[model samples]
Target: MKSIVTADGYHVPVLLRESVDGMNITPESVCIDVTFGGGGHSREILSRLGNNGHLYGFDQDMDAIDNLPEDAKFTFVRSNFRYLKNFMRYYDEDSADAILADLGVSSHHFDDSNRGFSFRFEESLLDMRMNSKHSKTAAKILNEYQEERLADVLYLYGEIKQSRRIAASIVNRRKTKSFKTVSDLLEVLEPFTGKAKEKKILAQAFQALRIEVNEEMEALKEMLTQALDILKPKGRLVVITYHSLEDRLVKNFFKTGNFEGKADKDFYGNLNTPFKLVNNKVIIPSEEELVINPRSRSAKLRIAEKL
Candidate 1:
């Protein structure tokens, strides 16, 4: 397998083999790789495809392009997978045989101090744009969100029990001065920070901003909507998610086509939803893989077939 990379060039792979194995690829299938960080997973998927098979990849970070292998059967979409429906038109059919997504930040993004994805880098810029051309920045989220709303994001998205204190700290500081980089936020978060504690907090804070900036949750819903409609009957969807929010979204959708799964069924007593779960249980990394790549610890793999 090839190496993993973040859009900014940091290298890490979350769940290397489990994700691809979930795809159930064949020589004749056409595949789409969403969140193509580092192209490690993409290369593995491509290896399974024959010359007649095709691979389509999407990443907002242009840096990921350099890592992509040159191939005639491959197409790369620079836009977010939210537009996956529109972009898939360029392929053999609007529908695909299989779809795979290894979601969340890349190794490159976390490792690059300049990008500031990690609390580990205090001196770095707070600019967490996967696409730098994108207007919203983490700094803006800190500077702009209403205190109550900000607290809600921290509480709900980041799961911070002390979200009130965190929000208060952010708002109070930003009023006196504009926060510029990762270090700026770290100073305010210093009191509550520790290795384990810091990771959860930083991930949550980063998630809220990244979601707002990239419209990630919305994009995911859109992709799910489009995917359910476009995938051929029995076509497979293999997803690897790193956080509970993402996992919850996939779990609900797989179970009920809607995240809440609250829809009422018809007289015939069917699922009222279209998805038929292929892997009824969510898949986790094996002990061996987890030992090698700790990042896979949080990874959750879910699979379903179009119904």
Candidate 2:
């Protein structure tokens, strides 16, 4: 294992051992790490691979791309995980033996003050686009979106109960000047964010913006659907999600191969889904890992296999 703290400190792979162990890697396993942030999970998968084994990693962040390890077995794709199928088809003839995704924002994004991912960084610009190539930023959403739409994002993604009031507050304030920095938005949100729940509210607000900017939910659906198509028979699909929205999606997909959470039945009343649950219960970090990386507390690991 690399030092818990690296020079760049990109991201600590959440549920590292559990996620990879669920993949059931073999000597010649062809693996894909769809959300390779710091390459921690990718490195772990590589260590388990034999000479003929190959690993492909996908990440849109330039910082992650720059930190990719150099090795013949590892191929890094500078693209979002939403394009999983396209890249998978282009690279390997046979379907991947296993696929792993660690969903949500990585540690680096939250830790880096300039990225504007953390509410702690008040002076930082409200630009939470994970991929710089993305056009819309958090600032743009706050400044330009209609009150109803903004409220919808907050309610749906952040699960904020006072989304409407917050939206109204944002629109009223933005009429004077557009929101540009974290502090600018905080000033408007402070009234609603009680002293006891300020951090929680701010985090939810930031998560809503980040999800909107990155199209996280839609992309996740696309990736999950594509993953089902790209995995070989009995191949593993291991995902570690950080929030209920994402966890629910993964759970539903694993159980029924559908986001609607409905499992289709065949003529004989047999389940028609292509996947079978490998782990019925959600997996979380062990006490030891929690002590080492507190951020992993929110991670939920779900493993499924293609039928």
**Which candidate has the top score in lDDT?**
2
TM-score of each: 0.91, 0.96
| Local distance difference test scores for all models | 0.79, 0.89
lDDT tens readout by residue for model 1, 82-105 = 888888875546778889888777
lDDT of 2 by residue, 170-237 (tens): 99999899899999989998999889998899889999999999999999999999888889998999
Error of 2 at 257 (Å): 0.8
RMSD of 2: 2.1
The all-Cα superposition gives candidate 1 an RMSD in Å to the true structure of: 2.8
* Runs of candidate 1 exceeding 4 Å displacement: 1-12, 90-92, 193-199
TM-score of 1: 0.91
Pairs with steric clashes in candidate 1: 5-38, 6-108, 10-108
